[model samples]
Target: MGETGKQVVLTYEGVKKLEEELEYLKTVKRKEITQKIKTALSFGDLSENSEYDEAKNDQAFVEGRIALLENMLKSAKVIDEDDITTDKVNVGCTVKVKDVEFDDDIEYTIVGSAEADPGKLKISNESPVGRGLMGKKVGDEVEISVPDGIIKYVILEIKK
Candidate 1:
């Protein structure tokens, strides 16, 4: 998301995850795609070879992702756990919040844009909810405006 050449902030775990993914893409995935291409070449008739086309497309995608990951790693800045405080919501903090409208309790781990996994309840610091929650402490109430509507959340707790 930081395509403007801004430094990408990452947690320690985020860095490790990116490193592992880059390694897998470079080694296992690259080899697999190469074998697929070679096998497709053996089948002859390059003009009508769907396998060849698919393999080539996959190879391009893999290479592109590898380059993106490499660039991100080059500009990566890891957030130290020791520097994280519980006084307020910030990047790398786990926060428990209650939705004022729905009356539902939700937990989110705020992280850098690169490590944000919404399905896993890990939100990017740049996200609307995360941005609204930042610098907020327990008992603080916040209203986040989104495209759909406004969401109100109360800060219940903050953890490391």
Candidate 2:
């Protein structure tokens, strides 16, 4: 939806989150910054007014964020639920893998780059682990190359 070159893949939940953020920025944050600017303007002497300058900077940041959100939304592609399959690794699927070296099972929710939150076990398809898991089904073993060394994992489960 964005310009010809830009494409942003997102899940339904990701789209909702972005829409909520955009709404908050346009309504609440915009108003708060506008009020700050008005209060600063009342101080008079714009050349020496640090408050005014700060408010202007805040306004610029907010506007830039708004524009960025708009562009992202324009290019957003929501992955459909129907497209999710447990037979293989893909974005929007949850996968459980056993570390060959550690002998521990780790779960990861594969998502687009826009929604990658490693702390929450959500990984981007571009990540080393995610890339190694792509198109792999349960019982498949993968060897992923990381910066330190190669990590080996066996796919335990895949869920929608």
Candidate 3:
């Protein structure tokens, strides 16, 4: 959590993934970076050593990522799978929608920002389409505004 006190919403799987990444960064990555730093130090001349500079930069990035992961975990609110319902569009719901213009059907899993992966069809609840579909029923029609333009979609199904 940051000073804003905003909670980081995550599903059980998302939490597990983050935890695993955090563990890897703290254990394996930290040790590897430390070794690199040591090896670079052995080469002498700190000011002009490119290896040392690169190693230090990598160390800083790793430390920063560790801090970010820790903060996110501290503020994480895991959504229970059992609590998800098919009644309406909501986080953790997989929605099937028909694109009005192209007449194509697409399935999307609504997830939190931290778990949103467009390539995997996992959309954030705050996204344009996700927001437009939120609280909508199976037969509901929605118009979502994207960077390109407005897109119309009809909700066909909602499942947990």
Q: What is the C-alpha lDDT profile of model 3 across 1-160, one tens digit per residue?
A: 2343778888988889999999999999999999999999999999899999998999999998888888888898888999999989999999999999999999999998888999999998888988998899999999999999999999999998
Candidate 1 per-residue C-alpha lDDT over 32-122 given as tens digits, one digit per residue, 9 for 90 to 100: 9999999999999999999999999999999999999999999998899999999999899999999999999999999999999999999
Query: What are the per-model C-alpha RMSD values against the true structure?
Result: 1.2, 2.2, 1.5
Residue range with the least summed lDDT across 10 consecutive positions in model 2:
1-10
Local distance difference test, each candidate? 0.96, 0.91, 0.91
**Highest lDDT: which candidate?**
1
Count the clashes in each prediction. Answer: 0, 0, 0
Ranking by TM-score: 3, 1, 2
| Model 3: lDDT of residue 79 | 84
Output the worst ten-in-a-row residue range by lDDT, candidate 1. Answer: 1-10
| TM-score of candidate 1 to 2 decimals | 0.94
* lDDT, candidate 3, at 103: 100
Residue lDDT tens for model 2, 40-144:
999999999999999999999999888988888888878999999999999999999999999999999998877889999999888888888989999999999
Shift of residue 83 alpha carbon in model 2, Å? 1.2
lDDT of 1 at 145: 99
- In candidate 2, list every pair of residues with a backbone clash: none
